[model samples]
Target: MNDLVCLLFQSHVKMITPMLLKLFIFASVYQECHGEERVDQPDPHIAEFEGRSVTLQCKYKTTSPQPELFWYIQKENHFPKYMLKRNKYGGEDNDAQFQERFDSNVSSDSVPLTIKNLHVSDSAVYYCVLQPTVTGNTRTLH
Candidate 1:
């Protein structure tokens, strides 16, 4: 099933920029698929026109039992700004900045970040950190 998930995701990437599967991890605590292998993570870059909106997708191939995903934005020369600091369940968090402009949602293994009312200040490098709910060592695709 994990392999199938990776396959389906790979096929989906065709419509956009091609994706390469560069990481494979074996995690034991994940109940989704202990021995299953997954791949074809999300693209690392996103370009959006000013005043427009964009959905940043973070997809990872893993059966991690309770992966709590966090999205962080780091502007050049500035510290990383975090979204969804506390309330992390579903729906948009009512407290970030600028009228709750940033909204996030998660799917099986992907989290799409939607930033509204884009501005020059909103431009930055975003990162998705998925730390399993269980404690364990971590490594990412190279």
Candidate 2:
């Protein structure tokens, strides 16, 4: 009886071990192959405006397990504004700029930045940035 039990246990472990190893390797490869996505790859169209408000849109490509959405604004020869509104994990941080003249909605798949009460200063080009949960490159717009 003891010998039989020992043989059965050893067979079970051997069978499970290879499966576990394969699963681990597959998960690792999937992670490695899919990295942070490029939100503004090949550069999106530069929106031109002569109106009170402007909406800048970006099309992104990502296979991220988790994604965070953001919108940034930068005037000619000016630094960028890191504004966060929504994320994939459901965290919302309204930036000062957004608090003032911006209203937005975000999701794991898409981010839309709407600027209202636009002034001449706001005439500059805007960007839609997507920050994924995974540690990788940051995607930006112009």
Pairs of residues at least 3 apart in sequence or in different chains that clash in candidate 1: 30-65
Question: For residues 5-59, what per-residue lDDT tens digits would candidate 1 score against the true structure?
Answer: 0101122222222222111122223324553433233765556566677676766
What stretches of model 2 exceed 4 Å from their correct place? 1-36, 41-51, 135-142
lDDT of each: 0.51, 0.52
Residue pairs with colliding backbones in model 2 are none
In every candidate, how many clashes are there? 1, 0
- Model 1 scores what on Cα lDDT? 0.51
Give the per-residue lDDT digits (tens) of candidate 2, residues 1-142: 1111000001122323465557545544654676546564233443333344545555555666666666655555554457655765667788765687676665545666666655555544455655556556567522
Q: Per-prediction RMSD in angstroms?
A: 11.6, 23.8
Poorest 10 consecutive residues by lDDT, candidate 2: 1-10
Per-prediction TM-score, please? 0.57, 0.55
Off by over 4 Å in 1: 1-41, 85-95, 135-142
Q: Give the CA lDDT, 0 to 100, for residue 46 in model 1.
A: 57
